[model samples]
Target chain A: MHDRISSLGEKKLISRIISRSRSVFGSSKLMGLGDDAALIDAGDDYLVLTSDLLLETRHFPDPGRPRDMGWKTVTVNMSDLAAMGSRPEGFILSAALPDLELEFFDSIMDGVIEACCHYQAPLMGGDTNEADEIILSGTAIGRAAKDRVLMKSGARPGDLVAVTGPLGVGAAGTELILSGKSTEGFEDAVERSLRPVARIEDGIILAESGLVSSATDITDGLVSELGELMDASGTGMRIYEESLPIGEEVPEIAAILGMDPLELALYYGEDFELVFTAHPAGIEELSTMMDIHVIGEVTGGGSIEMVDKDGATYKLQVRGYEHLSPA
Target chain B: MHDRISSLGEKKLISRIISRSRSVFGSSKLMGLGDDAALIDAGDDYLVLTSDLLLETRHFPDPGRPRDMGWKTVTVNMSDLAAMGSRPEGFILSAALPDLELEFFDSIMDGVIEACCHYQAPLMGGDTNEADEIILSGTAIGRAAKDRVLMKSGARPGDLVAVTGPLGVGAAGTELILSGKSTEGFEDAVERSLRPVARIEDGIILAESGLVSSATDITDGLVSELGELMDASGTGMRIYEESLPIGEEVPEIAAILGMDPLELALYYGEDFELVFTAHPAGIEELSTMMDIHVIGEVTGGGSIEMVDKDGATYKLQVRGYEHLSPA
Candidate 1:
């Protein structure tokens, strides 16, 4: 029944987005995100190719800041490549703009540009169109060493679980922002939610170690993603609730909202952090380069369970957004 | 003022769209169109990657037919790989659903599954999320013979212009459907518009011939795509209007709608038809295997013109969607 939206006039918006996206990083890019197509070097065997679509209303809050939306699109796709243990070579940014304002697109692309430059990734090629709504789809191509690519099925029982950054901060921070709470002294938490950086460094380091078992990004927060890892590997996990690295600001925000801090940390989504499992010996070396916290261990059971600080354990329900769940 | 529009709930609709896409193509796909990550094969030396985003109000008319939306998302990306003259291997579909419903997404994926089977393409992996409106994005991977690939810049002046199928039907059919005009006895026109087939076979034949000067799909329409070919090669072209192989039903529809037939034929987008320039010597051979049409010839100067029935020639203006134009 929704027929009001039309692709009438959005030229200015598309231009603003395209111009700001000109800034990209990396050396192997023969072309970067402006042409009908982007070409890359697919060395020897294969190239890790991925394209992700980030909608304004679904991926982030509708009234969310444009900078965060732009940053999240690139970061999420980069996280996809990172999970594959690949180094980005280039990306194609296809944007469908709803409005034609320079300010609107410039702010969004500013975040995208910053993220690409930070990750040493370059925009390779993409399409841009004027639609009734804002749509950003990115195709990123990365490379990986032949024998070292990690996968979800690589985790084994007895493997130690670790995370690259503190868990639940992004969801907690977003909850605060959505509720109109002040983020004056909590900029880090807000940034964690808005511009949650992909663990590119950790992905590379983990891939090279040869001992890390498996890995994936925690975009859907800790509970959902951890369960995914366990499902993929055909193993169960026992997590320690007290061991979660909740952001310092989360407690303050939770207290302000009179919400349960643990639930905010557990159920909220869009973390963009990395959850990985490896041998306990690798933690010391990994901690030198990243803020990794040992949160759990793989076990023989068929389900996931979390033990609270009070020495009580409970079954972790599959409560996050499941792609196949009934509406 | 648009802040309220931006803050609407979108991700809530994606679950319905993705659920309709489960295991339709029959594969042991580690993941397909819902998970945070997808695992696929690392085939040979190269992977063909293509992504397309179809907006509900912009790309299609509302109340948006979910079936056509789903089908177009998959076919459009498939068309890109076809433009590259590559064989379909696998695809990952990501979508933003406006709400939770099985009917729309199911019908759409039904079209997608049919196309995949028709082309022998497989479903590999993807992600899904709900959004404020329906936006379908698909990433397709194909394998190409490294050195045998064709590029848009390969076209040279003096080459003969060719197209794979009839044009203007898609635009006309969509107009009929959207305008509430009767599609009775216009079944071909309706199919052409709702589900324009990608020139996959012609692409293969063209690639194998080693004769195509340069190529691209008639996405933005005949005139605009030809402009792209000319822009890339730094050449111009002249076409005889009477030589264009318009579909038989196109004229009838144009007459009923009281619109210019030639204009509709030239400027209609989403044709998904292939247009290429090749050496005159390959004309006879190429005509046998495909529905090849010679509408014009490439000129030394970088301009495009069409000769009317009266033999008066005029410059052809590009009138398709311009990405950077101000809204």
Candidate 2:
């Protein structure tokens, strides 16, 4: 009689939703649920649509700056479009607020505007409502060339897996904030957590070059993202533990928290880095254009494994940021 | 130093938000923040985008069914697109949920899917997150011919104002719910409040006829909607008090609750009726097609007034469901 959403888990909930909802647009809908962004055929290109929600205390705890919250809300949705190799066009926001100071609301709007300007995404329309707590939702709409759109289900068995930037910065920043530590030298990590930039340019370049076979953004940690790609493409992956591009300060921060740097880089989410599969020749070409680390390679089977320098492999756990699962 | 959002009011807050956000798309954006929906040029047609938020206590109190909540959420956003005379293409939802019963979540999904299927709008993509309370946000995307889309600013002097259907049923339903009265006899009112329908067909018909001068959905009741149209078009209105198409049961419900039916009809939000302006010939033609009532006429001045049968004119107050304002 276990019928609660918590028992079903987030993935199962999503699957149930997809199963119940049928596409009415027919072939005009290029992509639907279970993808990074929904794709709709728009004559010359495919329109990308995605949404993300951020709640108070859950997404950002007390003493969190309002501007940061606003910026992060917009950034999360932008990251979805970035994963699809779509150019940021515009976004609409729906926010619910409790009784609060006008300065707080102003600061949040300022942050959202800053992020929109930074990404060159215009603020199109929005709704404001009253609630018991602060909740922000943003939907980003973008466009990409019909053939150049990146997908999570396009990876081949021999494709090389790579990341656009360093990992664990977001986790490190969260730890710093929760611990109330001064971010003097770890400002980069703090910034990464508060105002992380989506890999829009990198995705566009990779897509246009036609080098990347499949792509996804690492918002829910590295292993979880790889698992999604593997699940969608019906392929497995072998990741090298030492090949992860961990930030220099991550080790020190993890040490202070009495946690392993590698574990932090692996399990901690919200990194917002592009994790993609590319052909070896494409990887060679992309390496010259941008800094990308070859962290893994796609395999034929349906299991994700991590190999250490000692030539031993361990099965990777499928644990990341699931919404309704038991903590 | 009084900087509370409540003091600034919802209108001022929206103005502040619009002032801070700049448009990046330029000419391609046919319409922006202040309209019912944002319009962007998409080659042959214009894409209409709008978003709405629904919170737990603010939008729906306890004893409310989960399916109704989901249905209302989608309906509210669809109303926005309907006001713009846009055909709904698809929608993306972002929901924040607390640890709740599985049946509650399932019921909500059922309601949302029901609405989407009824409207022929597909559920494209969504994000789910954890929160302290249930918060749902939906972004509706639609398409409309560039020249045929109705706008709030298209009203001209001498245009006749009309409403598609009866009003005050939503208010009557809310009153019944708050009083815990039996809904056996007032089932229609209860249904109106809980499962209000968006007038999508009426909007499409009016837009196709090319006769309606301007259009807006009465989500915030009749008075507030007229105020918006007046403000946007720089025109005034003179409404005949007796012309309001009040629901048959609203008067009885209002009398039982010791309230005036006219006041309830004027102020109660969530009616979801289409309030629009048309030429006299257009009104004559439309009256033959649908149940549209001629309630008022557009004037030259920039003030809205209600004229009684005795020829006395009273300035109408712009009070409706405003968020973040004093209760």
Candidate 3:
């Protein structure tokens, strides 16, 4: 096991897999692999496609929460489309299921249906197979104006970095679930974690506003995702730590778990919010239409650094839940 | 275990999953569930999407042959597109890997890349996660002329049912693998099982010819697939038992295993061949172009029956490998 893929870590393994030459078909791949989502060329628009896998043991914090798993699976895929600033057209799923109670299966599907309904991503049919574990693979297709699509590479020095909502709910809720903590006033955090919303509307609004420079949804921790934006754009981001919108329950949950709320906000991930950079003028205009939190600014430097209210700058840790890596 | 889903069978389970009202999203689904492949309406063409799951234990005859599994995974998805008379646009895959050897993973991806190269379905890169087993979910996107797309419900009475090529190779190859038999002269059968072609060119030509009335790809077996066409079109078929293009190796393999080649040809699925119904005129033209096996004729009767060379009729058994059921 030590010599297995886990030792290589998720990033390395993915890099290795996608590093394979993509020139398979004759036509050029507009955008596939290594991007927020795969984009296929249409006449006047681009087709956004993304896929995510959720395994029972790997993704499900508690085995009894099949419904959350279903919702999260679909939401995760949609989140990728949101990152690319597209509206979902349809959903395709392939599930490897185990022999389980009918209610468990039904509950999972109910959550899947509910999420698909809420997101306007119609559930197209998928394949099902008997397996040792519940393996859900979700693919979502969406469309956006060819010119309006967001990429991770367009951020500039003057662009202001923003997020759609508070973060760390997923990390906090998962902690509470694993710890068997009481679900008292922390229900919001748990709800957000179990049923995170894809920022589809905000993404579309941002892309159409033509004010945004770059964008990506925060599936991985903020720092990790920001790293992607930074690396892709060949730029850096200077964060105002005080401006970090840590979840309401994050403080209490961090205290309860003896962790740092800022750490949860910056690195715990699972916040299905959009982290984007846009012109200040566009932010002022778009802020009236939707909630926007300007947390940082893109910079010319090549490293992501966070500045405290006291003016101390520190390199942010790039850590999140990486698949195929040791926990 | 007795109360597990296996008791429900693959057909029942799939029907139950897809039976959920596709009215989740308001925009009418072009062809989401219960179709050969889900179709999304574009300007002048339909984008076809299909996803299939291949489990390590269930799909791989020899774990050492990760290469074959990778190839089959892509080929199977393309096979669905072929059934719909669509050409490959791109391929997306989500692989759930366990703590695996790098060589094993590399070989699987190599096969995947090679197949994508061969089929002109560019690799659009997908997700990878660590799991308890190697669970591969492959989704293929294809495009076809909206007017020329084939459907299972279009076969009318008097149509001739034809196949792209011979059958039973999948069955024989699998038997050879499972039986650990010497594959001296049966390499072709084994090869077909491992690296089956997705009849894409033939399907496009058939669809464009406007002679095809109905079609489906053989995955569950010829009889089961034919039964699907029969049920969907509300028409029956009179298959000539003598005309079945059973692989030449099937007879020897069957004799070696003390089994009947006809049973293997009829019931053991995974041939990946296209079973389509076309007009007699189209068949004449298509026959001169590509390999076409005239197996039967669509009838107004309600049951699929086989007419032996002896002139006796018998109901073709509709049994194939059903997932989620005791094999």
Candidate 4:
């Protein structure tokens, strides 16, 4: 008795597949599935491996320039390694592309090369094939000290929840592009959406400083990421709606789009910012070292609650970026 | 100027991409792009990384069972590492699938799990997305002793060229399937094509014995692989047509299909067998250890020739599986 994958959804389908799979390396693997990346013991350090897939019309609806698409492809995979607090080592890219102009291929590769150079991660090798549309898959490998590796399952109750940078910038940028508005004053938002940077250095700093108890990256909105952290850590969270670190242009863009600024900050994803939990005593030190804002506290229960400024509380919905759902 | 990708061809397109991309790791990387896989120096051993893309129609035109497609997907990437004489460790699989029956997804994952278990390569974490068609990408990470890794650019003149197993079986299998012929006596050939095995043990044996000077797996026919070995080693080859290893059912299948068995042996691809070069003295030992057939000898010049039984020589055409070619 089989059901449609659309009915199961992406998350349930992945969980089913992972449940059916068995681990070949039991002892040597530090972390296996369900984490941002897999970690294996490599003698002196832990090697991190992660893979990401981006499809045309799905990941990038209007991938304006090929170069930007290439850059985003690598950045997305690298973001996983950043969540694990690993140093970028290298990546192998496999692309299934349609018959396009050579200039388009060149532009896409230019973006890939530029991003590699920027991150100091070399392009090792890859495979290319012909397909109906552009589908890019990148597998990034990195290494980290075993003691300094960050995990989502290590949060404790009462830990302060924080973000490395402001949220909703990527979502605002997406709005500008989709609305066909001039990005004169919203350059920062558009750039954030088009070229989101992985917070690799910040993750490393948090992990090395022994400040972060649990960490994950905000690719699928703040609430979604917090839900994952809570699921992994077996903890709940109390988030302050007023404490959300929203970018300056987010509110203006939200007003223009007739959307709630707080809703955008809580729901819009692809920020690629590090969301981590730390002890309250270390919050000031973390803020002094980097642009971090305390937004919540890990609670004892297993439900997420958002408190408004007027002392009203609402249960945050678990909806985020879901793939394979009917539009 | 914009040119169509078809005119540039797949190989040329890859070359252009590799030329445009730069290596971020200068001294630490043992091998970068343009190899079976990239080799990076770990602390004690070399880490091998490779990625391969498989599309639904392009890769598996008649992917009879979902399990077979999944097995083939992982097998293809493992074969790349096999060419490098690296031991299989783990792999990350990223899939972009459309809304399909749950049985299809289950069968595919079953095949992937079975292959991983068989190869002892654990399944790490990966990304899944929705697409118009089924697209699977696998990135396999492996390890090898720094001195024991095989490379394509190490063959010297007078080295004997050999293959691990019979050639033409995969081709004959394809023919049988395409013709809808009976498989009473051609079961071996059909199995070869449907479930080809990667010669991982033979590769490791050859590498550990210090016998193989250069090696690569036969995924794109014998002549194409030999051509790559020749180009990488800066040498030529003289192959004996009578020495071509044809399977038992190949001749009969060729007779039925009105095709030349020897031509199929040279041009048909997806064998997943190891082709290597070594000194004449080591050939006998290698043959004793494995089912290796001596088919040719490396020469000083840069051209490939095939000598028939009657001593008539013909210049072998550089025809292999070329993707995106105008048929």
| lDDT, residue B203, model 4 | 80
Off by over 4 Å in 4: A22-30, A258-260, B22-32, B179-184
lDDT per residue as tens, model 1, B146-218: 4544556677878999888887888778888888978999998888777777777778788778888888778
lDDT of 4 by residue, B91-186 (tens): 778888889898898888878878877777887765678888888888888888888888888889999999988988898888778777676788
Give lDDT tens digits, candidate 3, residues B15-117: 6767774444432674746667888878899888888879889887777799988999999898999999998988887888888878788889999988888
Relative to the unseen true structure, what is the C-alpha lDDT of residue B292 in candidate 1, on a scale of 0 to 100? 87
What's each prediction's TM-score? 0.83, 0.97, 0.96, 0.95
Give the worst 10-residue stretch by lDDT in candidate 4 chain B.
B21-30
List ranges where model 2 is wrong by over 4 Å: A22-30, B22-30, B61-64
Candidate 4 colliding pairs? none
Clash-forming residue pairs, model 3: B221-B269
**Model 2: residue A113 alpha-carbon error in angstroms:** 0.8
lDDT of 1 by residue, A1-327 (tens): 422111111112222222322322222331222211222334542356667777665556533588777777888888877876778755555677764355576567666656666776654344556666678887776777646655665678888888777756787777777778777888877778777888777787787777678777766657766776787688998889888887777788888878877776766757766788887777667777667889989887768899989989988974553433343
User: What digit string (tens of lDDT, one per residue) describes model 2 on residues B1-327?
Assistant: 857887866766776676556444343443646778887768878888888888877777444598988888899999988998889988777777877688888899888988988877888876677777778888888888888888888899999999988989888888887787677799888888889899988888888788988889988778888888888888998899889889999999998889988888887777888999998989999888888989999999788899987989999888676788775
lDDT tens digits by residue: candidate 3, A127-233? 77888888888889999998999888899998899999988888898788778878688888888877888999999998898888999988888998898899889
- Kindly report which residue stretches of model 3 are placed more than 4 angstroms away from their true locations once superposed: A1-3, A23-28, B1-4, B23-28
